[model samples]
Target: MPCRGAAACSALAPTLPSARTVAAGGQPMQLPADPIEAARTWARHDPDPETRAELEALIARGAREELAERMAGTLRFGTAGLRGVVGAGSNRMNRAVVIRASCGLADWLIERGLAQRGPLVIGRDARLSSEALCRDAIAVFAAKGLEVRHVPEPCPTPAVAFAARACGAVAAVVVTASHNPPEYNGYKVYGPDHVQIVPPVDAEIAARIAAAPFADEVPRVDDPLAHPRVRPLEGLRERYLAALDGCLAPRPERPGLRVVYTAMHGVGAAYALAALERAGLGAIEPVREQIEPDGRFPTVRFPNPEEPEALALAHALAERTGADLVIANDPDADRLAVSVPGRTGGFEPLTGNQIGALLGDHLLEHASCDRPFVVRSIVSSPLLDRVAAAHGARSVATLTGFKWIWHAALELEGRGEGTFVFGYEEAIGFSVWSQVRDKDGISAAAVLAQLAERERRAGGSLRARLERLYRAHGVWVSVQHSVWRPGLEGRREIEQAMAQLAERRPETLGGAAVERVIDYREGAQARPSYLGRAELVELQLGESGRALVRPSGTEPKLKIYVDLCAPADGEIARIEREQRERARAVALELARFVGLEG
Candidate 1:
């Protein structure tokens, strides 16, 4: 038996105390001390009846032993709080899970002496069960005597991030799974500063949440928990649009630019097109099938702008309209991907790296008079550094999460330094506005619409412009590879392999010389430095930038990020040829060892 905290060991089942008897390693299994009550709590009050039934079934079948592994404790809280599949187990996301998390947040705020302040701001995406989960948060926060202001409409995750600053609330919670599937939803917490909680703060908040008690009954306050003080925010939409629109070459006269937009059945379609229209780029066409917000994601299985199939409909529309450009937003519209036709008449879905390079170039040449700096995720392409150099700006690389990028922006702004020209994560999220405070595709789309128009007027296509960019800067090729790391066994297997690789530090990958291997787990890198280690192993590919291999912090997958740099024009063809051959050779090794299917 392990020494466990009281919260971790709380009774998960009022009906069946015997349900937890199970074995790990053929010994009487004991739940972990870290999140002791995780399993039992779910068994008792998780809102999903199906999940609850599933847990009850699992427990009744004398399978409680497995429960120890799943719920030996609470889910570990990272920069992003409590993201997982919706289910009735300790490992899954459920109502009880949310309640516990909210309590933890409330306690943290009270400690900060922010509990008595005006309502906390809560926003949600159009994911299944998201609205209810957000409402549950409002209920709990209101019961705690903390007022609440809910963004009544579905919004991108960044909007909630911005609202944290806009409302000046103590905390902001966004109920979104980000780019995850329909079956998944998550809880994201933003500090009073509108940045995701980092360092001692996240841990401190989790500890408090783990220590706090759940309210048995919803408290009836002067303001109904169901309805926290709601306020109508008008200009936030306009301000974000204006800020994003400024990123383009304000060529308003060319009404000939035709642009196709798609939200991909997420919450961002309306605002994205609106921004484009406001930018005075008239020809705005929406992919009608994906226009409406549907949490089930009927049109596409994966709601990612970078996904090829996700934009198939959008591409078809582009072909139909001969549109100058096609832009697609993910479920929350935080990330944006553009599809421009190639020489072969097949529209090419530009990699996140390609878009970043173009957008960086566009902004560098014509950014706000404030003269902003560019921020990119460490895992993204380094080509932005070249563009920044040309524009006489700087590029800062942070951890993979957008939260890090957001904080980096705030950091620069706080110093009274250059304004944030642009910020992006490899996974398609971009923030063009220093004021909106988070990634806004609406802004990106507005700028992209105008950029497309300007390119048209100059007698060149956006694709042609990209080619010119490649010619000038350098040919940069970046690829993200994901391998399955599903369930307990698979996860363990992947880790064991990682451990072996770490111990034997490979000299090369796919014939490329490995200059350095950054192993995160060793004691050589500690605390503040190790904060970025969410299971990461980076391979520095000589002068061709590097490749980062890490498990997805948000999903059950291992990600391989590859980047190659060469002289601009001919380099694209050279890099493409080399990339295909080298990628094939090296990807095989990666796939074989890492167990990647795609």
Candidate 2:
């Protein structure tokens, strides 16, 4: 059942020059998957020769393993759809997986009985595999007697979700890895309502995809460069922009905010700028180096806005231009982060938690809703709890993905259960409205711009608003400790950590004692409500809140989310000191416990 020898491996190996083998028991274990052949199989009928060659070379010399590793799994279709490295494996998001997933989605549409009245819309990002994945999806959907409307050019993923509802399609698919390395790509599914598919729907779709027969079993066409869908959705951008216009409330103050925008080599610039103007914030500038869509992602190592390094150019440009704010969107533009000047004349990147807290406060105070329910994920800060309580509104915590928030929102809207107001994840994702089921950076950018304008006119800055939230809610300071594991051994090493931590739970970290421990692995709450749950330990130090650990569903990283709520009179210095100490303690303990090399 296991690979025995390199000599035996070479027999069916795609004649690559070298093999990447690792030692097992004693023999060099060959990769169970062939990436070169996977790439070849993907590219044999590819329309673009350059793209095909690029994939071929990348896959040839053990590309199969890389692809298999990336595609070998299902790209993880949880509350959030697939987000991972793009390669030849089923685990990764290769064209084959996209085809399989799309076919399965088609079956779902047929079964749902929405196939005749509605079609499927396809959208994508600037990732290398995005275009191919989109094409693969289109072909599959078209063959299933469903109309497909493809976005003509690279665009933000939310637009596809938005267009699904606008075009009367039953569902939508966006091919984007979204904030992962350039080597990664992914697929996120949306229902006709333009929100993510939740619970039984996701399970049903995955099942249909798995049950799908061979690729050839479906319709096969030798044609390339042909439109598989009924036609490209040419006016998708305009429709989204127009709809965004209606979402904004009246401007609070000056029409110009002098903002610096960056798309992070993804497809968010045009729409984001439109949003700024729509919010009556004019003269917004974009960081040229990162605005345009570039698959190579030449500027940053990873296209995540959460990373300070990725926002370096934007921050620099903001300072030089003396802009009011700097906004950076992740590759797919589903998430947005901002940087504002601190006391020392330099910009500080606001953590996703900080931004979400600010937005939560603003929406709760200003939104014209009928008792809206605020939603956030487990990994996000509980600061929303404070804000929601102040408004007499109910708040719900779902698993750490927008899918959970989307489902909660849909449930409320469906039964007129409750008004869905604002939802956000700590990782730069926010759903300000239910217009789009998935997070929309463009829409949120507009909303944020409006909020900033209103606040500036009200005698405060976004920074001030955050500080106010800090003062009112006792500044819930949070930090993340992530342990990155590279290969299979690395993966095993990381997974082994759960057992280790469970066995040896820390009583104290940097002098902060654990008040309570929530073992989500035991399904501790006993409530039948929570979905996609995991082990969550509530480490309440002498301070506010502390989270022990959880495994990243999308990545091979062991995550420790730490939070400390400081007092109102607490100086920024005190908060920073504790954050540093707590972060150090967690990292020290994790590193010492995990026993990985420095």
Candidate 3:
């Protein structure tokens, strides 16, 4: 059948020989009946030569097991959108999958009468496959008769979110796997509110994608960039920089605060540096080795800043230059990591909870609203509640994920509750200003730098400031442990583990009595409207601490978070050390109960 639409129809046609025509060992290749037919269909529809040949090779060799794994089913488009290894088949992230997803999104927008509200903003990261996937998305949307605003270059995820709001976009899409491996890529969708799509919206769009036409049959503009409905999204960088101005509170310029930064070989260096310069601390040193964007991430084992080894280069640079602080951003610049000079010798990295607490306190102290509020994920440290109480600001807790955190903030502010000052999760994700409705590493880094400078002027270090906060509130410490299990069987094992833990709850952990247990899944009716039901369990341990266990939303792992605190009447250092050890013990116990190792 001749494919319709676009002069580049040949691109969608199979460019390789049929798998049935090739033989292995000079004999007819024998393959499974059902899987081979599906593979052949996938090969015919895949527009990229790499994925097409990949499927063809599998079919030629009669690789039934691998083929079955690849063609098991379509990739699930959940709230986070599509994410998987870059390869052939419907289960992976390829041109065929991206085309279908884009078509479905276009249809969903048109159906909701949102297509005419504003142009759809699209952006990408520096991954090897990001550009091609972004191109396919733009072409699909344009052919569907939606105006598209293309961000032209690799940028931070927060930049895309800001652009979505800046241009008043009906929706936005970004082709970047935030902090995932190089072999992986993703498609993230944002609604008109400039937040990630949640709940019924995600389900609705997924249904549309399921009903979308095959890759080759979907209409696409051969030259989407040149098409009348598509135009270059200009001034995004400048506008994003201007938007970051709110993060820098009016403070005297205290120069000479030596700060070291790293991008982890991602797309955050340029935007971070620009934001810092605009904040007046322009003499920041960049880790030359990992400053630029490289999809392969040659310098680190993983691109995530949460991984200690990922910040090894930045630490080395900070030590050599006698820097005061070190900051880093993940691949897509949606999360921030900070390290300070340790009391012993080398630099010590702060947990995401600690950073969140610090930023919350700082912003609340400087907040101007009569009624200010801060938000945190339920899994975050309870110390934020203490800080908010001290400052007389409301502290709200929601389910994990920035989508919920931002949504909670907006809901409260809209209800005359309070002005949203700051919000963060325990995964190094933060939102410092209201302009960018998502976790913004660029602005967070700027605000952290300002905080460090303010402390320096007062003859105090970040460590000293943290200690002061601990003394004022209580000494709070948090630790996270993850148990990773891969593949389908691993997923089942994880589910079974959760179920077992839920059935037999722990009475005491780390010698702290579990006063109350809150099963988020079971208490949907009693929970507030903003907090939805999820597979999460929380064990509140009175004043001693608390522990939360849930499966990671973005990765194949079970994550456990433990928070412990003590009065600062004794030595703060000794208290923190003891609490950290106790928290680790609690985490290990939880892991054992769940049939996994800590």
Candidate 4:
């Protein structure tokens, strides 16, 4: 629900201000020594009238705890960049925070002489506040006399990434929360390499942001839409589409297959549908209700395609059309979700790891480029490594997120160690080719469509192809479970839980004895190739499987991932069933030991 300003946020305030007052992540809403004064200071400079009124209402009602929570700490740059619920205060995603972040980025760029390197590119999605935030960022950039190239309309996140590299921009900023809920919005920054900002750079930009003036004090020009530096992304889509076409195999053999595609009420339909058609695939049937871009995302609880519920409408359409496959993209169209028909007359959604493995195998099988290699997140299924090895390609595992994946790909490509043929994280994000160094649902969707069609022409389904790959590379199954802990206290609890688990290493997990416990934080030093510092724990359970536990980089939850595999000794069907059952049992046990039950 949209928080109704201060009143709605303050309804739960208690008699006396206490340090234990819960707010975001269940963290104690420690009241500032002078909460009322702090609220007044923040409200005075708040640029958004709605958020200003929100703070004023809380101040008027002596909602000190609520006010404190809102003003406790400014939103800092993280793995996902600046993101939070849209509302008042430094901690939220209101105009004030956006302006400050822009100013900080501007200052960092100018200080580093990056403004002289190239123009900055900006793009936005169809989120409610996206346009407004884009304009706000433009105002700051223009005031600083920096050249800017802006996408005139809502575009996929990858478009901005591609434009940043293709346009030779020093940095690019996309005003989107990606797959976050409707109430949230975010700003993601990409460097000249077109990868997300990492450690030292993020810290430097954050320092500049901390030094930026308050929202109201920030200077701005009259209409950023009329600014001279602002120019539309002319010919960008054509270039991106051409690059996408390069991801598919030559002499494409697309069968007459029925496909159901949905954008999940996002800005992807135009790009995705066009890509599918360009791939010479069969007729496309879109989920009518979800074909258009609607920021409200009224049809689903969350806009993320990774969530099974988000694809309910697409599944229904698939069933009605007897579609051979279902493909979906999140709101920004940067991630993909694939579902195939099941025995019970319903569509079965594939896990991110499953999709990754399938795509990795398919891409490797049709290798055309030299030095072909694959990349996957460290927590993703290890089956991709075996697939790459079987195909005589190298596989590298990096920290979670496409930022690291893309960065590592570039590093490899630069040194001629390998060329990034394909990359994916176990979160429905994939980069079919290195043309765009980010997870691209539009291109990934196109490649998947072509692959599915080819499989269909061979009188086989994706399921059959998957089974074949499993046979070639032993049956491997994986599952992900998350422990939700919202608010600040929840974050602390998650940290404590991780510490407890790490300190008290279990001698056995599930029914198997633990062979070794790897703490990534400690092992990072030993492994120089590891990207960044991460709080992760991995348990190697002999031959049964492996389990990895870590706190979510973006959300207030503890994520646990488990993988189970067996040698392909029996019939494919029996092996698949046994492996799935074994995976489920192992996942359940890991969850009990490290997730919800723990």
RMSD values, in order shown: 9.4, 11.1, 9.5, 9.8
Candidate 2: lDDT of 283? Answer: 76
lDDT of 1 by residue, 346-462 (tens): 688877777888777887777544545888988888888878888888888877777777667666555566666777877777766654556777777777666777777788877
Worst 10 residues of 3 by lDDT: 1-10
Best-to-worst order by lDDT is 3, 4, 2, 1
Q: lDDT (0-100) at residue 309 of candidate 3? A: 91
Candidate lDDT scores, in order, read: 0.69, 0.71, 0.83, 0.79
The local distance difference test score of model 1 is: 0.69
| Model 4: per-residue Cα lDDT over 321-399, one tens digit each | 8789999999999999999988556989888888998888888777766668888989988999988998899999988
Could you tell me which 10 consecutive residues in candidate 2 have the lowest summed lDDT? 5-14
lDDT of 2: 0.71
Models ranked on TM-score:
3, 4, 1, 2
- Candidate 3: segments with Cα more than 4 A from true spot: 1-36
Question: In model 4, which runs have C-alpha deviations exceeding 4 angstroms?
Answer: 1-35, 250-255, 571-598
Candidate achieving the largest TM-score: 3
Compute each candidate's TM-score over C-alphas.
0.86, 0.85, 0.92, 0.91
| Residue 564 lDDT, candidate 1, scale 0-100 | 72
Clashing pairs in 3: none
Q: How close is candidate 3 to the true structure, as a TM-score?
A: 0.92
Window of ten residues with lowest summed lDDT in model 4: 1-10
